[model samples]
Target: MTLHAHLTRTVARPLPITSVVIDDAFWSPRIEQGRTTTLPTQEHQLRTGGQFEALSLSWKPGDDNEPHIFWESDIAKWIEAASYSLAKRPDAELDASVDEAITLLAGAQQPDGYLNVYFTVVRPGERFTDLRDGHELYCAGHLMEAAAAHHGATGKTSLLTIARQYADLLIEQFAPGGPLEGGYDGHQEIELGLMRLAEATGDGRYRALARKMLEDRGTEPFYFEAEEQRRGTPGYFGFLFPDRAKLAERFREYNQSHAPVREQRDAVGHSVRAMYMYSAMADLAPQLDDDSMQAALAELWSSTTERKMYLTGGIGADPSIEGFAGDFDLPLHGAYAETCAAIGLVFWARRMAANTGEGRYIDVLERALFNGVLAGASAEGTHYFYGNPMLSRGDMTRNAWFGVACCPPNFARLVQSLETYAYAQTDDSAVINLYVSGAATFDFDGHALGLSVQSNYPWSGQVDVTVNTAPTVEKEIALRVPGWAQDVALRVAGEDHQVQVHEGYVRVRRTWRAGDVITLTFAIVPRITRARPEVDAAAGRVALERGPLVYCLEGVDNAGDVAQLSIGDGAALRDEWDDDLQAVRVSVDGTRHLNTSSSLYSSAKDSVEDATITAVPYYQWGNRGKSTMEIWIREDESASF
Candidate 1:
């Protein structure tokens, strides 16, 4: 099935606003200027000054044979950011810098279309020897994405041609009857990327190649075992793969056998790898019109969102592997909710939402974007956190980039792509996934439509939308009323309209004139959410949730073991301004229990009773001097007089 046919049948009309253009208003002088000013890092990395130079001086060509999974991932981010910037700014220096990068990339490409500095310059002979640990395919995937982005931003085909050569090499090396048939990257990303290349270049061969790679994963001989034996279990891949027998067992345990490309569920393995694999599955599912794949994807989505998810929509609860442990294992402080994993959650959610027209997918996406992804980057957009801890200590250090700093550039790229998730489309319908104060104009089904959405969302609940186009067409507009909204009202032309709501979206179909305004109001009620009893981390605890934002108690603002803090039953949550704090603060008649005992981990004494305590939004926590923090707190069962 073609993409257009699938969209016509399943997707709603009026495509969502994708961030094709750089958001200069929110990111311009502040964020863009910051990126440019940070160019010294890029220059240093490219030449001989910063960490890259330091590594390059000691770097032997053979050293590149070792798996440096993120060696090129960082550069891919910069290329994406540069393309986005040049698309919006069209500055001469930006163009020159882009051209220069392209020139370097072109020069670096091998005669066989291979283009990775590590493998090309560092270890040429051992290029495909270590598929289990090496990121050669992963790096190629990112290059393919960057090439597509560059081609889209500018009509230039230089980078595209270079990437095409690399893709050709991949096809030749990994095809069904090629030199390497049983080998697939332990990290699954190139499949989805190669598909994108196929779409961009209109090449059926690339799509076939991508399909072959996905289908060949986890078959016979098990690629990782041979690689591990060859390398004597050296470096990060050992940690990632651990025991070859165990890894193979887990693959079979997850039912990842040789059936079809889309019949797997329950996210497993490295958090990022699982998401990337699922993303490719989603992309290919619709293109192939595979119902089994869609069903499995839906099941996986539900499992993640309904049980194995943080309030912030961040997954991966197992700190050991930095991946999902099981259902409902969300621990606060010990959580290894890696920033890249959260961003990957958004990636999977957006693709599923776009493909299925399901509001639940967008709901998860919004929660992850506003909380999970936002927590990774500072409000200033300069500093970043590799691990997005729901609760933190003052001693916690934020790394510029970790041994796996793939999260940083991934975060930046997602922020740049934020505009795309706001809207979605089908033949005769449009779905608004996010409510932001912006406007989007696009072509769908041969009709030009303009939609203006004005709202102070995440701060306020009122969203007003105005639609304008040629007078003769009728279209169905779907507005998402968030699952958190308890009471929602929709009005068209000052008259209450009967709306059909399913899966968290209110659909209003009407034959539209040039000037039609549809207003939607979602009730933002501050409510307390409790985890299921099986979730030991949140047992006997309640967390405050308003809209999609999760609230937490920070020790800097609320004194002592935030675990023991409790609010009075009749305590009213009122919004108040704190001039010193410089943000909205929540006031509650809550009492703090002082742990009189010397032992830190002791349970609350029998003498403890209900007291007044205050709570604040989790995002606003840590602004003050960090002490202790807690998202899920024990609710005192006794009522206060």
Candidate 2:
């Protein structure tokens, strides 16, 4: 089915607000804090010969690989966050600072439409030559995304125009008939950004270009082959090629070759690259009305959500490849569920929710937002974690920003742009994807509508939605019944309605009045979920889940080595109030078997015994002092004992 038709049937109204509007509260404080502290501190470090900047750009002469702009993904993230902030507060003074950065970008752009300070100023004449390591296109892609976002937020076209010109240069240089024909970025991103540009600007040419880029990849030998040959070795140095055929062949060999763009299952490659490709596929699949592509995306989505994803909806469990290692490879200590990857997952999942109008997508998105993405930032939102470890020891520390601290800014931008993902649209239907206290006003099919949703979600399960629309406009309202809500009930206009729940949504169509109120109540029961036996980490274990939040047992909260702890049978599960955590504490009655003499470096795995293990929402795991944690634990069967 075409995405248009699906959207038409699934969403019949317009989202009152875009993500750009929602993310401000989450983004502005961070920007203000950074402006006064983080940014200046880093700049001081750069100026005063601090180790961070020195180490970042150390690849230069007489120094180690010092902090290169592109080496740390944070540069792009800050740009993105600045774009978001500018969008939310166009008239504010901070916008001027953002404009200053944009001005820097403008000054940084070359006549050829290329804009990389490091490449153009620091190392000239080497453009596109170091495909194995250079991040030219990758940088361009991020800049393009920021440009589009800035344009979208402010209605000013200056940055976007610059980005457009840059894209034009790329098109002129790399189009099938152009100078750089038959090549694709080994670090894929421009394709997705270009597609987003097309959507933002209503330009078919950009979309066509994005499609062409996807189609053009992997056609020839690897784009990096020549560079690798020149370098006398082939290491995954980053940017490799633009050859569509060769890239497709490599993707096929890697088992990502699905029939259409969407069918490519399993995540692979540099975490960012895989996500960018998936994002592009998501964008193009619906626009082109390609079911095969959607199916392919669905396959990939299932692989990640079902078999590969962490409890936080974060992908990429392997630090070695900075990507997914394999199914069920989630090792707590070594797990590299990068914060940026989680942000990317949120990005992809949000698109899927829009495309399919399925609550499941939003469910996953919420999981990522509340846990994986939230974990990236501290409660105060200053310090950040680039890697969201499932389990953390006191040894784990939050860094200010890493050489690759792209995740923090990305988190900032996402938090700033979060409002848009909270709601979705169609001509006559509206679906509320999130339950946050907010009001939205938008026009749908010439009908003026206003929606106010008031609820404390994640912290509370009650959501109240009030709709005000044109008297003559009859609309359907679909409320997402989260997957974790096994027993959900909804009341409209104080009347009990017999509703059918399908695909995670309860659809209600009726004539609406201005003050009509719809209340949805989900039985947010705390339950234990057992993983399939094939999942090694989850063998003989079960994880706690409440609503959409996955619960874990942290050693700080539970007095035992989490790794050796096991839940005994016949233990009653009880909920106790913990004022310190401000959430319900789950207590399980089980015996705690102590292996006091076990050595830390023992070759033999510690034996598990019956014990009372209390688990809290995974989102709250790291709030206490860092300690061992476990999401899944053994469920004892000896209840009668």
Candidate 3:
């Protein structure tokens, strides 16, 4: 596994953010809103919350809002998101603000390149003592990612210089035979961040360090357990749980250290941690050409998306650990599908798509992008939901901020970097992974190839691709045919081509000319979807799906609580445009069960009446004020009283 091995696995490269321009009716405005509204609002929150000030190392003991172990990562994610937004749409005020934060961070760095405010300012000598709860490496990973993003966006290496210094320190202290040998972060993030750093710096050492960390994880004599024993205390958050015996097991599994990374096939532990770790594994497997690692990732992906995932593409069911429950234990109302977890799933999905060149990964990516991840932020972009629940009891609503704010910045960065996920390219070919309306430039054998896409995706299934400029040499263009589409019709310059699908992509190879047009039409009609019988919660229920969007019934659209509504399996559904939402709404023939007896545990069945149920996109549910929302509706029965 050397740099040569990494180069050999290159299949397709995501077009740089600067090379693609998004002019979408659905996504353009949201990206702009994230830039103007979300980033600014989040910056204010970070500043007011003392995160920015804490970067200055000014916090003293007993001070208000004492710097927490994870605060740096929050601000680092914000900086990364702000950098992406700045890359697309520059704001002088925002740029200056980022510069100021970088200055503070640079000033806070220790002489040895260590840079964590909590350890440096609050607890000076306890730097690497408690890796399980310190979050030191996790914060370093985020800073490294932020530095890479900032350097790419502005071409300024000030942040990168600081990040690399810290990374070098980490490698020296944590690598084999080093002082912190056999130790890794309690949280699984630095591995992914090291990969990014390697790309940013064009340095193989970072990649080597990442590989070492991954290989070292899940080996005999767990690092976390050893580190915990060295501390000789329960570590932080130990007092929260009463049972000491169960607490040890919970702690080990919660951080994903129960088994070795390669042998750990099931998607266990904290959902976000598992996603990040699996994402790093997927990324390195191809680079290192490790077959066993790839196999483990595939099994973990199935365990996650197939058995543990919700209809909305949301993972993690238990709120207690803010992570996963057992298999098929998904509860619609009690779901703790954190927005960051969904974003991590998207990260893993994109890497998997690149690794295997498969469209199935894109299907799950699109599902989470439209529902689980998009539901995190409000339409205005100021408020956010930390946990996205499929069934809300009229109480869950977006808030301005949280004490431990992670999702807002995570959501901001993902949407800002949406263009990179839309398409990937190599020297002689390109792959369209998403259907967002955008224009992109790619290299075709040293010649510039220009392409523009036009589509009303998620709302409609028609897409038209035009080649503005092409090379004389023949090149291949691969368009992903979504797994959910019943059939896809393809045409090139008014000529219908045989729909020859390979590995879930329709690859068209030819010498392109200017003004050449390619058209794709998919059967994106509303359809009923049912879960597996193993899913006890949704065994007798069905959900609605149109294209990649999952539809949910909201109380505001339905006039009241939607808990009692039931749609028949054979009921007819119509798609109608709504003025309020400005999106397609699904109307279905349903029956509402009214409890006439009104007694607790009554033997008498409830009476039912005909109803016209209105459903909106799951992503657009909580926008119309607080309302009851439900995704899985009970199947209508013939014997209703």
Best by TM-score: 3
lDDT of each: 0.67, 0.66, 0.87
Error of 2 at 25 (Å): 12
Model 3 Cα lDDT, one tens digit per residue, 84-126: 9888887999999999999999999999999999899888988
The total number of steric clashes, by the backbone 3 Å criterion, in model 2 comes to 48
Q: Tell me how many clashing residue pairs each candidate has.
A: 17, 48, 1
For model 1, how does the per-residue alpha-carbon lDDT over 1-641 read when each residue is reduced to its tens digit? 11121222335432422432323233333346445643324443434322233223245645433435456656666676666555555667767776776786776677888766666545556777777557878877877887877887787998889889988887777776678766677567787678768867878677777766766676566555666677664434556444646556664333233234455566655677778878887776775644777888888787778878888877887777678778777787788888888888998888887777778788888888867876776544555677767666555645444555577667766655555677777777777887766677656656777777777566568888887564347777788877778667889867898766887788877777667889998777667787788888777677777777777777767666666677644456666545664434665666566667788678767446545555666655555544677777666666443
Instruction: Please tell me which predicted candidate would have the highest lDDT against the true structure.
Output: 3
Worst 10 residues of 2 by lDDT: 1-10
- Model with the higher TM-score, candidate 1 or 3: 3
TM-score of each: 0.88, 0.86, 0.97
For model 2, state the Cα shift of residue 470 in Å: 3.7
lDDT of 2: 0.66
Q: Write the per-residue lDDT of candidate 2 for residues 188-238, one digit (tens) a residue.
A: 777777776776676666777777766555444555555456555433343
Q: What C-alpha root-mean-square deviation, in Å, does candidate 1 show against the real structure?
A: 4.0
Q: Answer with 1 or 2, whichever has the higher lDDT.
A: 1
